[model samples]
Target: MTLRRLISALLAVPACTMLAAMPVQAAELDPVRVQLDWLPTGDKAFFYAGVAEGIYRDAGLDVTLAPGRGSPDAVTQVAAGNADIGAAGINALMEAYAEGGAPVKAVMSIYSKPPEAVFTYEGSGVTDLASTLGKRMAYSMTSAPWPGVLRQAGLDPDEVNMVNVSPASLAPMLAQGQVEMNLNWVTKQPDAEALMEAAGRKLKVLPLSEHGLEGYAYSLMASQRMIDSRPEVLARFITATREAIEFSIAHPDQAAAGLAKVVPESDPAILEGQLRASFPLIDNEISQTEGLGVFEPQRLATAWRWVAESDGYAIDAIDPAALIDSRFLDTAAQ
Candidate 1:
């Protein structure tokens, strides 16, 4: 066929038919391994929702969500190149960075405010930090309020007799009077309440942040290599995650179903409640002003100082700017 004749013949065909005959370009999905700081929980339902709903895939990521031992484990895994990213406490990351140089940097702040709290039974007369003195308490060794928080509350960390306890038994221990109180996140107050009510007791939750121990909470940490070599991949992941969080915030029930599909063992209602609880933590004055996935440098710097200085590390040991890069968040927002 002559070139002019071929062009004429193509033009004569239906545009839809011609388009169908053209080769389609399939975009390759980038691999992204995320190490969750602990076993799957309702509070983390949005991650499962993101996967079940194809949020990550739509954003060009072949994301794998894996259960991790804890924040320290996740940080070490990401720093050792065993994982591309880590979902863990921002304070833990700062601690790791203070130890030396962590190979990861925070890309997004998952919790705008710290979620640490102390739980007690009703009429226990354990009202404040002063009441905790010489009292038996169960607390996750990993998550007790730091020295700075203790000082802010005007209590000595050494005054409290703290016993390490698993989250599963923390409530039961309190019910049985094995411990006067326990510590956990306020978001889990509902579950704790349910547990206490089942055991015929009332619950009192005292959030440490309300007493001046506030700091940035959970965050998304990416390996420095991934940030440097595949910035677009991280940006896409954040965009997808942010969208999933927004959807969960708006439709907790539907988002819970999405999570239930991924983890049927988890009660959908519990997951929904957990997701609902996270919404307040996710959206605060800072988030309202700066938008999601963005962090205030001054506040972040202050948090770093609080964590590092309190931990007896030199202020220069960990540079807050280096630990947080807003470029990906800016890109994802746009």
Candidate 2:
């Protein structure tokens, strides 16, 4: 057939038939592995929410969320390249970077204030920080900040008889009265309170933040390699995460459902309560004044000071500025 006749014949074919002949090409998505500081919990529902809502995928990223045993594990994994980014306590990152030069830096702020608190059951007579001077308490590695906090409360760390135990044993010991109290994060308060209530007692929370504990707590950290080699991907991931955080705040129930879908063993109602409990930690005075996900210099310096003093490391060993890279956050804002 002549060229004009051939073109006319092709043009007469149905649009659906023409479309069916075309090959489908899926958009490529960048890979991002994220390690959480602890088990999948309500405070961490936002990441799961983001995944469930396809926010990361919409940003051209395939994100994986891995549960962590602790902030130390999360920091170690990120530093070792097993995770591109992680959620960890800033103090843990500071100590890891200062003590061993871990190649990780916080990219965004999560908890603006330390969530450490002392939990005790009713009738334990531990009404305030001063009341626990000579009482026995469960102590674990996460209790590092309590020493400095105790000193600030005008009580000697030595005055309290500390029973060394694993993190998992803290609640059991407190509920059974094996220890008068135990140190835990405020984000887990609801669960702790429920445990105490099950034991026919009320839980008394002595938040260390009110006892002169000052510093950034949980934060989003990234491996130096990722921050250096994949700045754009990191920015996109951060932007998507920030959006997920806002979504979690606005719809706690939806965030819980998202997390429950991924972590089927989780109770959505409990997760929702946990996410609600975290709002104060996320939207506190510092975050309010500086804007969300921002790291103010003075606060960073103060955080370093508290961590350094608590760990007996020289405050000058690692500059607080060296522990964070805000360029990605700036990029995300753009």
- Candidate number achieving the greatest TM-score relative to the actual structure: 2
State the displacement of the C-alpha of residue 244, model 2, in Å, after optimal TM-score superposition: 0.5
lDDT of 2 by residue, 175-270 (tens): 888989998887888887777788777888887888888778889999999988998999999999999999999889999999998788887888
Model 2 scores a C-alpha lDDT of 0.87
RMSD vs true structure, all candidates: 11.5, 10.5
- Candidate 2, which segments miss by more than 4 Å at Cα? 1-27
lDDT of 1 by residue, 1-334 (tens): 6999999877877786878865443458888889999877777878888887888878878888889988889999999999998999887888887777788999999888788788998788789878878888787765344556777766787887878877678889988878888878777876777788988889888877677765577899999989999998988999999998887787778888887877878877777776787777788887898787777888788778777756777888877777888789989888
lDDT of model 1 at position 265: 89
lDDT of each: 0.81, 0.87
Pairs that collide, model 1: none
Reference-based TM-score, model 2 = 0.90
Please name the candidate that would achieve the greatest lDDT relative to the true structure. Answer: 2
The runs of at least 3 residues in candidate 1 whose Cα sits more than 4 Å from the true structure, single-residue gaps closed, are 1-27
